[model samples]
Target: MTLGHSTRLIAVAFALAGPFGLASQPSWAEPTQGWKSYIERDYQAAEKHWRTDVARGNPNGAFGLAILAERAGDAKGATEWYEKAALGGVPSAQVLTGQRYAEGVGVERNPVRAYAWFARAMAAGVPNAEKLRDRLAATMTPSQIKEADALAETLAKP
Candidate 1:
């Protein structure tokens, strides 16, 4: 069956659900040709496509930009884009953003923020996110855990 534009867009949104491992690209998944160019190693074309999508407020575009920035060793830019995508409700971006916070990559090291993002990712059904959140919780003080839980609650998608 032919997928509608919205359905194709939904597929694109979830395309990064795993670790940069999009094995095959469906023919109709070209609204954000960024992922296609990215897989083909055409960084320039990917960036152009992603930038246009980002301009149009596409979270998947933000996720694509985050991957490109990370590839270029621009930790700060990657973190910014990842956070944008995460806030826009991209589960993979939430995980990456959590890791950035956990590792102090491009952002200050804050276990609280890491836990919060991980919790959000877990709630969004990202596999292994609960493990990440629990692992981080093991190192945090009770008060910190409480704060992280509160933050995660506040940031939960409606």
Candidate 2:
């Protein structure tokens, strides 16, 4: 699907949140209160906390929501939240988003987009992101690679 102007703008903003076009790694030592609630199987409490965080523009909140959605078997909802978190500079979300794109789990499979996300994740120091990107690259035609490269370059701009 072609990204609209606002979507592209959001993508650019997300790209700006990270180093080399993706957000830096977040500290996982202190899980968000929402995440804590989720771990305790308090779905209602976790949703409330995560909703508040999302309202406050906290990407981790989006990440938490994604997890909750996944747990509840909402593949589409989970993917949407994951994309939001990834754009907001969550490295793990980026990888998840990339995987989703690669496999067409929630969204349509788009190798070019998948590669771009993987590139961003790799640049952000995500483990094995490079390997994933390279694997995807192996399946892409030269022109497709060029397109992915261009998209990655655009996303990399601060």
Q: Which one wins on TM-score?
A: 1
Clashing pairs in 2: 18-22, 18-23
TM-score of 2: 0.79
The residue-by-residue lDDT of candidate 1 on 1-158, one tens digit each, is 89654334335435534542221224323446887787677989999998887787677788788878877778999899888888867787888788899999999999999999999888777777888899999999999999999999887362
Candidate 2 regions with alpha-carbon error over 4 angstroms: 1-29, 156-158
Model 1 alpha-carbon drift over 4 Å, by segment: 1-31, 156-158
lDDT of 2 by residue, 52-110 (tens): 98897777788778877776778899889988987886777777788889999888899
How many steric clashes between backbone atoms does each model show? 0, 2
Q: Residue 51: error of model 2 in Å? A: 1.1
Please give the distance, in angstroms, between residue 15's alpha carbon in candidate 2 and its true position after superposition: 23
Score every model by TM-score. Answer: 0.79, 0.79
Error of 1 at 79 (Å): 0.7
lDDT of 1: 0.77
